[model samples]
Target: MVAAAILASAPATAALSADGGVAQPARPFQFTVIGHPFRATSDENLLRRSITEANQDKPAFIVATGIKAQTEACSDRLYAQRRDILDGSPRPLVLLPAGSDWAGCRNSAGRSNAIERLNRVREVFYPDNQSLGVRRITLTRLSANVKFRSYAENAYWEQGGVLFATLNIPDNNNHYLPEAGRNSEYEDRLVANRAWLHRLFLMAQRRNMEGLVLFTDGDIKAHVDEGFSLLSGFSAKQDGYAAVRKQVRAFAEKYQGKVLLVDSQGEPKATPAITWRGNLGRLGVGGEWETVRVQPGTASLFSLKDADSP
Candidate 1:
């Protein structure tokens, strides 16, 4: 069956109370997250199989983190092919960009072509406010704001009383360059991401959401230093994720609902795990596809399940 038909037949999350004057808490809902599936250029089959498997499970939607593998050439043809594959998915599929998708890109002349490649990627994948799949969902892109008009990839939507958003933080050290005066791309994106995060948090708060879920290519907490750096005295290696980490911590402190950050860069493991720090939680999907079941009104708002688990 097509994704739309399947989704239509799925159980509803919210229902009216016995009095018919108030609504009961939303029931649990599942969504699939496909980690970096393509390890090489020839791994297209792997991606196809992942999508097929995800469809069988019939999650509300599917989020594929990263389009192409590091080994894949940063070519327009490849990007187009991958976009077509995602568009074929029966489920609503959201694509998140990874460092491999464009950060390391180079022109034939051996000069950095990262910015151009990233723009091309955006044009190919984010053609509209809807996801790339047979079944679609409307998204609120950061580009809606005039100041951040170029960031269509950063978007958010509400599902099952939860706020779901995507931040374009690539895995290669957040795509930070050590060289001075050459970080226009990284710096600009950081600013836009901060603004997007603030907006997402404010919206969730205003709407009294059960929780806020963020999807990104890199783990924001992976390289963050919580304590003083002893090696370089008070100074530390330039960590691109520092700002985001700090912002998340501050926001989570005041927010009454749980905050979950999901990323694709983790070590390969049989089962994925979520580590919690107070109200903030982090889940790394690694190199395998995983599904998260979000249960409202539970002590743990979210739980991880293998994609193929029955």
Candidate 2:
């Protein structure tokens, strides 16, 4: 476990600010990545314990890729419960809503509209400009000039000499549905996402950032072994996955800096699927990129060190 090294060398209290805020440490700082709770029975206790443990660890911040419930009906109560649990975390939490949270509800037995569910997600999860959790951090989202100004879920921030960005790339083939307006929505979000990627790379290049991290709820690099990727293509009108991979890869190559891709998946651990963890970071660096399987009561710890350090 990478966290073991951090625990052995660094004091647990190193990330706690004197004023009860998150400490703004120098480069080589550590943080936590939490995927989502399993889609089993509706058990909030397990999630509460995970938050408690993460708070005890005291990382600089925490990021939850997305949450999923396997129940037949997508209930608003479930979403609200998940949001409340996230807000209870003692550290700052960055959440990225994914397909399971909204997309799959479209045309389901419950007959929920995808767009409406997405709107509800934003309304409930992103009620404020600041992030969830007790420790709130202001985010830089797409301003009024952007087409999807209501998408306050996308955000970017700088930390410890690195540029961290979260995009609203849900796993449902990016909403490339055949229905009317679905294609337009997908296209618009795609354009916005592309622009976001370009801007992130530009910021890194201009600001001389040491590394860049782009995380989302969707697994852009899904392969044949992953079952979720199979379902994504059914809703795609244009080849969104290919475009995203190409653009992000090109940027990483051009930047010639360490880049990390952190995402969450809905598949349970018992299923035989592609391994979530992989080595896609700067070839020689220790912690470049990997997927964290964050279940109830468990979180992954990692540090962002200068590319050439260690």
Candidate 3:
């Protein structure tokens, strides 16, 4: 099923309450996703304006997949600057790290340390159990208990009968350290991420969430506009990437509800937003699988209202 089919399956708005009063289930609300915002003097104005607009729009929340520095390599200063940008938002904000932010900066001129930079990101952006921005929501983090507990960046929260989650799944094959001895750290995170993901599905099931949204910095879907291939770096053989995608497909199929897989960075498969709104094509997934493309200045707006509603 494509987006149209999913829309077609939606139940129409119910009429007035048993009495004459209006019977309202919660109103459909929207949130914003800002992909990679590579900051520079030229982009300062645009970034500020986008935040202002999002604040005015008053989304239930806002999330930035990651922030990138124009020419400068990743550094603590850059991460702090990005944090300030996120904190400036008047609405709740959740920031997830992208490859450019850390993993890809391993050999930068700034003597960047991927691990330390990531730690700073979690420090400044995720200082508390609550989210950033003026309006905050407490999120369940995977770091609360575990050996790799500092990775509090993987977070989840529920809104409007939907469970939303963010994973630190960046590009570069999820930092799959292929070196013989350097693989331990990568392996640890892989295990932790999977556990968090499984827990998310379990919680969503227990809560009877109407839908689930999984957001990451990398495009995890199997197919792109050109057709499915391994070059996208999300091939079935890639360690962390493929495992998460398989798990997502399984849960989406079992839930039989809307499941939106959003990736911040990538050449969009369909459109900048709502890439391919249809069934999880090859996996035979049961839910309405929608892929949204969210990048700086391009925000997807959705409303819960029926187009033909009175």
Candidate 4:
């Protein structure tokens, strides 16, 4: 097992305040890439081995993408993680939502039929969204068991130099979007989400941090137009996907920074898919999630290895 200790510690990035105040930034640490841990059920021991193996080889902070459950048992897996893995570790566990989490609960209609499941998740992980940051939870081994902040489509918060903002976007399956016959509830949700995202990004710019992280449960490739790229025609379009994509792109370009777009609803890789995680906007991803090394204000969409200090 290659589960070596910490390689190095450095500042990821930093920013400034409008009033000439120096700003805080993200902590510098190696980020480990782990695909959806939620799918590895009925085989806890095997799953644990696989997870530890991946971690030992990569030695990254846990990025549990698309780790959802078809049944309520999912929450148990999440809770058990604390005892099974994260108890004494200082490394953080970061996550984005995936359709199998709740969107897959829908029947043929593609509606969120997983209300019970959703409620259970919310209860277990987030009886309070204010602390959860959408579905992205950050658990540090500090006091109070670490209340990881949660944001809507766009909400921003800072931790050990790193700032995290999340987007609770509608599922690519259009499950969250209102149907032709529905009431205006979704409309209200849309307006709220839009305003929230804008505010979060703008704040990051104002603080002169590094860049903002925009996390969603769905795949960014899914937001692209049909036949967006030839290699994997699996990318498709949905109702709000286009608009959100445009906004993210514009924000990054305007600030000359980067946006960290995460695909929470990842399927699996025939081979090792997430071995190399880096800036992927041009590859159809918006910004390099890994680049905002020290802070969001000075957000550079480049490689950390390209960083000057370390």
Candidate 5:
């Protein structure tokens, strides 16, 4: 297992202002986001290639949005292999779990083993308060809170006057289950997520951060106001992301800084794009990877470019 570092050796991107606010960097800083590097069971080579490409650009940090493909088995051996792969990054690398990481897991009896698998994922990927890589950065995990001790994967950090966080919203409909007594996992996690969002927004507001960026596997933007259907009666499928979306919208409305939501499970696009609605922006990254530049004090606080661009 990798050990935690008190602070990263990377150059300082942000500093504390005289007034105790977070000061912007002298210039814009860039970071890369790798969307589902392991797109297939045989994509280990692809994952390594993606990391090498991102490393060549020397971004402040790298965020890989998923560990394995849905078809991959959710087993300890596979998880260990992926963890080793992620640990090879020379730059600080933050990981966000995808639905395939846990949602469809099953036990020997063929029963849903999602919770057990999710915990195993947490144990492997988020055992400490630092990112995986040769150069590690400190992070604040939700598990620091005694009440939400199990959600170590929900982590947040700051860089260049921006607050970045990862939420456990998976691509499999937030892992919602329609069966009456089968939604305990989803319901419990929903509560934890709401509290985590509240804490993140409040921290950004207090620190006077320039912008807030969120990373997750699911496209929360696609589920805004996605209401329930009456046709299916009590068993009707509900929008698992509704509560979190509502919270994000409310927080963004009250926040003075820009809000960017990034996810990996969006439709594959020829070019990565970000759609804006007032201060709120939604970026659905597809293809291999996307790099976003954060320019503090600019009208458009953030800008996106394909990682493959020259």
Candidate 6:
């Protein structure tokens, strides 16, 4: 079955609820979101095993972040195959792109050009202007909320009462402003991307998402640092990246309790009453880093471990 055919199977429902509401109550929702399955060339079956492992629990939703559908060489085929598996599964699947998967960087080989590679990726992933080009194979589209194609780098949608928005922050796969030239155009584009990111956040806030889930496949505070140096070494897009940092901090500050960052291999930082180490590696994807602050009406949900695992 083709990707679109799979999603076209779901029939729309129309009904009224208590107080004459159209939307129904959301059931308990859960899913595993995996990152950077970069076609897993050298890792020798990392994609199959890690993905199979993460799906072990059979959660209601399975989100595969950063699946590059760009290259006919690597992820292109894999992305299609992943759709087949998820379509066959008993749950809904969503794909969000990260740095490498978005075709924003140079190839695994340093020789490949960025714009050309990204063009290829754009061709495969967002083909047909993100309207008719979703690589979905034999899946049904949900009426209330569903995405037909992989959303362009930064994408937003709500599932089961949870509002999820993804922002694109690619390494350009080591591709930056022409090393020495520091072209102003590239910087301008970077600035534009950052603005789009802040706008996405605003959209999320407007949605009044009770549970805001932010997914990124980069190193967030890769190591532990206690100060603004948490954002050090970001010299090229220092201003741009710093702008992103400020927005992230603002989110953390405003919704200090509801925000959750899901990083696959990252060890989260320590904050006063707001740090929790994840045990997702226990299930897979190392799970997530939940805030430590204990606020009213919030569950003291603790699944993360601290630095000391023993």
Q: Which candidate achieves the best TM-score against the true structure?
A: 1
lDDT of 4 by residue, 20-125 (tens): 7875444444444444455545333443444455444332244444434455344456644533342222344444444566554655555545544444444454
Arranged by lDDT with the best first, the candidates are 5, 1, 3, 2, 6, 4
Taking the tens digit of each residue's C-alpha lDDT, what string does model 6 give over 52-155?
56555554455555544334344456546544443343444455455555344455666545555444444554433121112322221121122313225455
lDDT of 4 at 261: 56
Cα lDDT of model 2 by residue, 221-241, tens digit: 632232333344453335457
Backbone clashes in model 5, listed as residue pairs: none
Instruction: Report the candidate with higher lDDT, 1 versus 2.
Output: 1
lDDT of 6: 0.42
Clashes (N, CA, C under 3 Å) per candidate: 0, 0, 3, 37, 0, 16
Of 2 and 3, the candidate ranking higher by TM-score? 3
Q: Tell me the tens digit of each residue's lDDT in model 3 across 1-310.
A: 1111112122233436689785544345667666565523335455566567656656778777656653555667766776777787888988777776777566535553777767767787777789887778899888887665888989999875567888888766787765577656577777888788788878876755556677777767643333444345555554546666667667766764456666655333332334443433221111112222111111222212232235
What are the TM-scores, per candidate, against the unseen true structure?
Answer: 0.87, 0.71, 0.75, 0.57, 0.86, 0.58
Residue 8 of model 6 has an lDDT of 9
State the C-alpha lDDT per candidate: 0.78, 0.60, 0.61, 0.41, 0.79, 0.42
Point out the worst 10-residue segment of candidate 3 by lDDT.
282-291
Model 5, backbone clash pairs (residues 3+ apart or across chains), number: 0
Ranking by TM-score: 1, 5, 3, 2, 6, 4
Candidate 5's C-alpha runs over 4 A off are 1-26, 222-237, 305-310
Worst 10 residues of 2 by lDDT: 282-291
